[model samples]
Target chain A: MDAYFFPIIVTGAFAGIGIGLLGVFIVGMRMPFIGSCISHTAMVGAVYATLFNINPTLGALVLSMLGSAGVAFIPNNRKNLDANTGQAILLAFMMGLVFLAVGLEQDSRSEMLSLLWGNVLFAGWGTALTTGSLTVALMVFSLLFNKELKAILFSRSLAEATSMYTHLVYFLFLCFCGLILAVNLKAVGGLLIFSLLVCPAAAAYQICHGHKAVVLTSMLFGLLSTVIGFLMSYYLNLPTGACTVLVSTLIFAFTSFSRFVLNMND
Target chain B: MKNCVALSDILIKRGSHTILQIDQLTIHAGEFVGLLGPNGAGKTTFLKLCCGLIKPNRGNVRFQNQCISRIAPGRIAHFRKHIGYIPQQAEYHAHLPFTLREVVAMGRNALKPLFHALDKTDYEIVDSWIDKMGLADRGRQTFRSLSGGQQQKALIARAMVAEPQFLLLDEPGANLDPNWKKQLRETLDRLFNDCRITALLISHELDLIPSACQRLILLDQGRIVQDGPKAQVINSDFARQLFGRTITTPEKP
Candidate 1:
């Protein structure tokens, strides 16, 4: 069937959908920096996995999740040493990852570029299956836990008093974030996955007040970015991953500026 | 002091500095404990320790015959469900969108799981508490929209809505005028009169301590230098030494 590419495209769209789902939690917590940090850190992990001849996705997933949790654990209120500590730790870890990749044989460099830049045009049916399953699981979790998440986000101590465990909820959220991040590496690559996660949610948040509405609109925003980015890349013969990210960034900026103008008029 | 919350030879340290050293303390329930301490007297820290919000490096806070920690967090919620805590000069509650009724519903927050939507009956209970506080018309108003006096009253209603068995407020009355303070104290008296809700009000202002309170616990330099009935502690040498000034009760006006 010449239309065989349709299902594969649909599978890639699942990654687009995950963008909307994860975006709400990221923006709600006011922790978009956490998403940015984990994404680049996953790249380092991917390169390390390549050197060891391991499943690079697994390496990226575990390291990104741990890095997310570790950032949360750092005491930010002590003096002026808040995000500075996170920046230092992330820098050191990224350097270590680069060095490990340098130690690999020179012949593997071409293959490793696929993981870094993404080769969405060459995506196979198996990649589709992986992306599909991850997106489904995330959808189910978000639907079931939305109410509980809302209460905890209000106040940690108040949530604890109400018998809601903030630590457990936060940990599960990171794990879910890590999974989406790992799968998206196949499409947008690690360095650019953040736009898929942050931009759409931010744009949605600008217009929508309700949490569920924010999630839905963000998914729509993400899908629009993906389709437009894909067509632009195909027509211009540019790198698909970079095009997708740049388009999403433009959409985000456009929406944000419009909201700003509207607010000023009011 | 008899049937008291006693701390025998208590030692509290903060990174090698022993902040509080106490040989003994005896405070009975149902007494309005005006916990007065100068700045850095560890008043807030002591109150937090009593609530088990933070664990001491050593020594324990006890009530009656049982320790607070051995009690489950659920049971503590049940215990604190009855205690209304007013933090000192509460500054952060402004800008919230919730109506006074919704803010009061936060007291019931200690009741159950996050997903358990508070039903119609819970709203009615909160509505009634507002009516009881003489704010029936203003009940629909958001908490931040009210004057400082009204906000404190709304907060008190929030704290007492679960009909907490004990009420712990920290310097909440500092913002209001003398008349408003009296109104608040009267409201508290009426609110907790029938119930056995033990009240512990924290304030830096010594004169603001309600006359209805039978006992006064004077804290200075992280130690309880004076603990006695209002008349005994008022203008006593122990009170003056703890205060670092001669004790003259504020004019009634």
Candidate 2:
């Protein structure tokens, strides 16, 4: 258990911080469904890579980027499908590809299931290192684009008017989000990653007054969820990803309750 | 002979409808111009084109003697830093995650390089604008927590903190109550009279224009019907035809 602790801790920390940061953007954009879309897309990518005998995470990264680009390429006009419908179409198409890949791999079904549910407890040192590096890279990217991001988060038109290549910045953000989801897919599972991405940040948003506070609180909530959930799963012999998401859901519940109480008091 | 902005052979089409078409127009330096039009008359679209938020389907837009459409894509950001744009205020989410002061600071931040942090001068400028907008006490409050009037004042401060030479406003005074509107009017008056900023303001309210504008341009069905002194343009029969109502004579400033 001691020997395995390092990988587990690093995995939890990186996933918490990365997903928490991305959750801020995702929630702000009002695109909660996109996180689920990205995660599932990564799952499809991972299965394909396994079939080709390559590094599954790398495959997931490339395919998830394609998934994000797919969303971006959708025409946003009255003559085309709306953004939500476009995303839904991409998600459905990706799921079909995922099923086809699974059906072809007769002997690798269990291996794919492990990827789907995420066996974070057994992820190697390589996975941990990848997660940590991606997390650091994402943090630096956020810092570098801080001002442009604020303008964008406020309004895309305002950001463009200010002379920022808002479309480029927006595409880069979606790509980064896809990358984060891809790295975590092995440890957090496709079905459960949405909870990790949204619940902690949503909980933090209910209480924090400033962007810095909200981001910090979101990271803290994500970290708490991951650590506590890992311990509970280890001790009780439960599913790690499910335990992690349930912990996050519980935190969201607690935050909502506290917010209600505070509002009533006011 | 010097023009701050020039639009030539401009045409914009959305779907199948031609939203705007202009052969030639020039806005000189140190001018406060009011843009008026009926609903769907492409006033906002024209502003977007001037600000370089949208590219004209045909022809060219020149700003500060540089052809905006011809400038390298990478240089657009540098060009935009000298222009301030104030968008219409809507109900900003109550949990928007930025304070009024931080929002104002964004203006300065936009002008600075990515690797640079806000320094003393930036903070001073941000604080001065916050104070000027009467948002000093509310600076520390989340923008979403501020009242609608306070938020608009904060947004105006954010736009002005950069101290841009050119300003574009889109019905900024729409949501403000009478008192706040009066304060905004005074602020615009100072910006135009004292700061000598080149400004183009778009509004449906005829009364707000006369006090703040020296020149006026009226659009009808996507074409400029009148462009001249505010008094002449507003009182013209063409203006009446576009507005579908009589234009009241404005008192001289």
Candidate 3:
């Protein structure tokens, strides 16, 4: 294997694990759209940063935080707009900003295009370290707040009524999710990362019956998808992002089919 | 007895329409009260107000003499630690992978500090409640797999596992069959009579109310129409007109 491939593989692994863990919450909460929204918002930040000669990662981080905060704090009530509607508005606004930023760029749009369809082959030691660090942070947060997160996922209202500091926990979880997506936006294309953030978890839930089992299985599937997808892309000389998404979708399809067969047998 | 919850000049509005309007109401500590009203008569709204789940458009809801609305949003959970609220329908996603044990253990989450795991004693308490609710064999089953009545029992177990000082149940018996309803009544009776846990139970059917609940409050069109002893409220002209028939109070268990 080429030496440069080491960093790319490491980055893919970390990104896969981080997004796979986050997918459980996203899918459990029925907010898979959040992955798309945050990634696009991060794209807007990255393009504008490139246009202004600033650090695209920093811009992505800041704007994605803002997007997550909007989703977290939006009043979900009968009189006011709900969180899903708020997220849709944010997503549309971000999409518009991304296009405007792209149009305003005077330099070669290669960097911006690479972000839309990620090229993990260009990843370096720095990218691997950042992804690794963020993925570790997510793992620690999940461990520390496992019970609280479970309660919140079960029902935010019930968790709040039970005095679980639900708002704070949920806000923190969203902020972490935004941060993970922002850092991985460059390595995993904005267009394809939502699959990594949702598919593995969806597949895990298809076959797993308990929370711990589902989370662990999701992480395993995430790791397997990225590693296998990377090897396939390297051998076939295909787009790494598209290959990863295909692998993830296949895994989900396989799991769903297995679950269907088992239920039929029962 | 000290007042547990006091609502004064409480007015709750959704948009321009009024949902609940109560001038004054007090529930004393260690008292079991049954709340009765028609489907849009604001029973759930009243319970929500008492639990600080929603703020009223006017007036105060005092918990242990502290105004809940005046309490900061972050600090309201501190007050809620003493309350176990069971809504009519718990918002549960169909695919959530929580077991009955974990669902019951959530009650302990409120009492413990952040990041603290449920200890053996907590699990023991949860198990005892599970047994009491007659779900001893289904601890490992996913919450979604339970029948409607079984799920209700699990929720009741969840509420009771906390040993909360106050419980607010909304139509807890709505999905329960007669046998389970009888068990629920006995459980409520024991909790209220023996443990002295102040409780407000909302039910559309008068038969679901436990025998130990002495006070009854009747609501109609967002107003408190009757508040008194159970028999008095049931036999009142207003209740008779509301039910459109005479309702003989059920024999005490």
Candidate achieving the largest DockQ: 3
Task: Give stretches of model 1 more than 4 Å off.
Answer: A1-23, A68-105, A110-119, A122-136, A161-164, A195-260, A264-266, B1-10, B19-32, B63-65, B70-109, B113-117, B123-163, B167-196, B201-221, B226-253
List residue ranges in candidate 3 displaced over 4 A: A78-80, A264-266, B175-183, B240-253
Candidate 3 per-residue C-alpha lDDT over A169-192 given as tens digits, one digit per residue, 9 for 90 to 100: 899999998999999888777778
Best by lDDT: 3
Model 3: per-residue Cα lDDT at residue B46: 89
Better of 1 and 2 by lDDT: 2
Chain A, candidate 2, TM-score of 0.92
Clash pairs of candidate 1?
A: B4-B27, B82-B164, B82-B165, B83-B164, B83-B166, B86-B169, B86-B170
Q: Over the stretch A217-247, how does candidate 2's per-residue lDDT look in tens digits?
A: 9888888888888777778988778988999
Tens-place lDDT digits, model 1, residues A39-125: 767777777888888888888887777776776565433335656566566756675665568566487886567666665766678
> Would candidate 1 be rated incorrect, acceptable, medium or high by CAPRI criteria?
incorrect
Which of candidates 2 and 3 is the stronger one according to lDDT?
A: 3
Could you report the Cα RMSD, in angstroms, for every candidate shown? 5.4, 2.8, 2.4
lDDT of 3 at B243: 81
Share of true Cα-Cα contacts across chains kept by each model: 0.06, 0.54, 0.68
**C-alpha lDDT score of every prediction, in listed order:** 0.67, 0.80, 0.85
Residue A174 of model 3 has an lDDT of 90
